[model samples]
Target: MEHSITVKQQEVQKRLADLTLQQSRLSMIPGFSGQINAGYSDGRTNDIVTNQYINQSIFNASGQLSMGGDIFNWFSKQNTIAANRLDAESNSFLLQKARNDLAFNVATAFLQILLKTEQVKVNEVQVHQTLSNLDNTKKLVIAGSVPESNQADLEAQLAQDSTNLVTAKNDVILSILQMKAYLNLGFDIAFVPEIPENVSSLPITPLGEMDPEMVYSAALTTYPLVKSDELRIKSADKTFRATRGQLYPALTIGGGLSTGYANNFYDRNMKLVPFGQQIDNTFNKNIGLGLRIPIFNGYQQRTAVSKAKVNVYNMQLNRDLDNQKLRQDIYTAHANAVAALQKYNASATGVMAAQKAYDFATKRFNLGLMNTIDYITTQTRLFKAQIDKVSAQYDYIFKMKLLEFYRDQRISL
Candidate 1:
């Protein structure tokens, strides 16, 4: 049992690893950069008109203090930031949804294994009872009291029952294999399902006003896909605003070094007027501000802004479609859960009645008041009732998990 427990724990841990995980954080860390640019006019003459007597050598030294966020760049940058934030949120919600779905599946498989195990046990009990009856009938045949035909009939019934028990055992094995695989267990592992006395009765929660409007309201703020769509819409809206801002004037501000140096300096010094002649310059320093304005872009910005708005519109459409689909699914799951609960109650009562019937049939068979056929029929009914009881238990559990999933409730095993 300890080994089985450890194996089960390890298996479940593997399944948990597969569950979708979500996290919240900024993708891009804020940063800054520093750079330097220098120009040297070793002996090149400027375009300035000279009297030839007033010699001049241009040694320009300046640096630009401009941010990447110009009127055009600002919109793109804002859009990118918005997209990153939205994408993060979208991914988080989607991961949460996937995890919830996996949790539901895990609960479902566990319950199915348990229910199938109970069914196999009931079948085994029925087979054993039939075998006992056959043995009793054989003893009577040896005394020459009961007819050999009765003994033959009992043998035939026992053979059929033994075959059914074998089939039921196989079914249990198959169920365990499927459950183990879902739990991420090794292929050679097996689980012996442990049953509790009875399932706790679930409270009756009315699905009265959970219509499209309610479900949408619940899902929009809850469901991962819907939340992702909402984030996309927000992202698109922000991107459109940033894109439109691109058409406006851009502002930049920066102040840094402006320097150039070679060897010497003078008033119009190092002057060599010959074309394609090599010369060296001295130190020069200067600082200034620069501004650029966009007069027109062949209407490219206009079209780009328009395209961004269209994307926002598309995202809105997606949100509406997702909301409608979510409502449909929630309603269906609610119905299934309610129906399963009803079946669970009915099956519980059936198990009690079938148990009493089997007990009475056993007493009658022992007193010779009931034949082997009658006893076997009673056992068959009891076995079916036990199957129903287990099936109902699992059905309710599965459907309940689905309902909880739509409601964004925490899952339990």
Candidate 2:
């Protein structure tokens, strides 16, 4: 997940760089352009003074250097630059949100592995207890203190307990594999989940007192996903303004230095003028400002303005949707956290009761007062209670972490 997030971050960074480049290009002052041309021409004309037909051929060359810049269009250029800058900021927030989501996923997967490992431990303890009970029952039967059928029941319970333990171990392996998959690691990974040995000691905000409204408000301001949406809406607004600027008259100031040469011209001595002399004689300079008022352009500008408005509206809707989702997630996580905590507490009480009952049953079974089937039933109940406790503990932890995630806070064990 980390590796994938890094790759996505780089992509967002590249987009930011491109937007920055666009901003720089748009903000720059307009510069000059140069053009040069050479050509030959042939023509015929009647010389009215001589009243006769005449023909002449001329070679011509011209060069011009001009400078121009947009004077005014209601600040369209500035608005475009602003829009691009906003887009870059939006992507930056988007990248952070992506990273946060990936981190949350990894944390959730790690918690699952921890829970499965604890279940495996619980299963091991159950197996050991069943094995001990089986040995005691066999000794009792050998001494003729208990029936032979009692010993047979003990062996059957032992087999079942052993199978449960194996299944539990397989669950641990599968959970580890799931975590590895989230991390994008290979199956051969030597994965180990780090969790507090005493989860009850870990400090967590009590869900009963947590205010969903407060959390949602904080998330609206601090969460990158929410912030990204806000920035996108701002970008769309700027773009819309820029697009509307196109409807106004555009003005540009321009200046040019131009010269031309024609070899068919005559000097003072009635000779064809030299190229250099012709250029100097024809040199021209001018400065002017141009304005364009949009009368009609097949409604292109109107269409663009309408589209920009729609974009802004869509972005606003998206932001609202994100906020709604965030609220739903926080509320749901808080509810789950509360439920899980209740389950954890109930499971703890059940474990105590089952333990006492199992202890009593074990003594009775040894003295041949309780049958093998009854003892096995009590032992399985204890195992189940322990398993439930482990599950509830991890479930509460994950739900708490999920709430933290929505609050734009880092999740920790």
Candidate 3:
């Protein structure tokens, strides 16, 4: 999705390009200009009147070249460039954070599919067991060892188990679709994620003992999102400094050269000057410096500076907020991992106990010492215990992975 969809990645690329263009604009030579003009006039315009000593209409050609730099404005321009560069760097990190976030999301969705698939298998096993029990009960009824009235109840239980299996299969399908949505895959694209045959359980006590503060500190140094926030604060600081430059004066120096030809000017001999000689004789040069003091700009500069300062403050708060969130998430994940581990252990115990009870119930039912209602109830409890075990096991694993993620660890099954 990050590489192909390009929904988020293209935005980052565009921002980077914009910043780069701004940097280029800032580094450009301050002021360099040249111009050339050629014209023929009947001396009708006041500015192009024929020379007073001559009577011919005016014909003129001229050119000029000038170059200069804004010494004072350069400071502000360079500072603004530096600020934009920092912003671009921050966005680079943000892009990395975005991709990381996407990976985590996809991983979570994939885990959901795996969990749901396991649930479907569990449901299938329960339905198979229910059908077997129904068959044994039917045979018992035929042999007159049990009442026929029990067959209907057994058949109904079998039907309920089969319905549950169908629901479980649909759950798996829904989870798969959710995973596909995360991948930005088309509905027509079929996908089946690879899962290990078994996932070994990890000890949650050590994870619970881990310090959230330590994990948060590690994450702040390691995670791109944390680093991106820090960079944003720095970028805003630079922008604030750049905005202060508008309060200062701007200075520049430049010079120009120009020559013109006129058909009207006369030489020492009192004859009309040739166009080439007129051009040589009418050449001129000038050099000067300029300074622009910013008396006032309707408080626009002040407003910009104030806004930049506020942005800096906001960015600082954002960084702090991220830190707080990281700490909270780490603590929450640790707590959930501990709780899930306990639940899983309890479910495992329940499954064992239920298995024994179901075995006993089976023996009793086969011997005509137990009723079908009680046997079916025992079987349902056993199935529920097994499902709970699966749920808790996956829950614990996911929580543990979340804690690891907070510590800047990769999440993997």
> Which 10-residue window of candidate 2 scores lowest in summed lDDT?
45-54
Which sections of candidate 1 miss by over 4 Å? Answer: 1-74, 144-185, 188-197, 201-221, 246-307, 352-375
Candidate 1 clashes between residue pairs 3 or more apart in a chain or in different chains: 71-250
- Order the candidates by lDDT, highest first: 2, 3, 1
If both were scored by TM-score, which would come out higher, candidate 1 or candidate 2?
Answer: 2
lDDT leader: 2
What local lDDT score does residue 385 receive in model 3, on the 0 to 100 scale?
A: 98
Q: TM-score, each model?
A: 0.64, 0.81, 0.84
> What lDDT would candidate 3 get against the real structure?
0.79
Better of 1 and 2 by lDDT: 2
- Summing lDDT over every window of 10 consecutive residues in candidate 3, give the lowest-scoring window: 47-56
TM-score of 1: 0.64
Alpha-carbon shift of residue 91 in model 1 (angstroms): 1.5
Residue-level lDDT tens digits of model 2 in 192-236: 777667767866777855778888887888898788788889989
Checking candidate 2 for backbone clashes, the offending pairs are none
Lowest summed lDDT across 10 adjacent residues in model 1 is found at 20-29
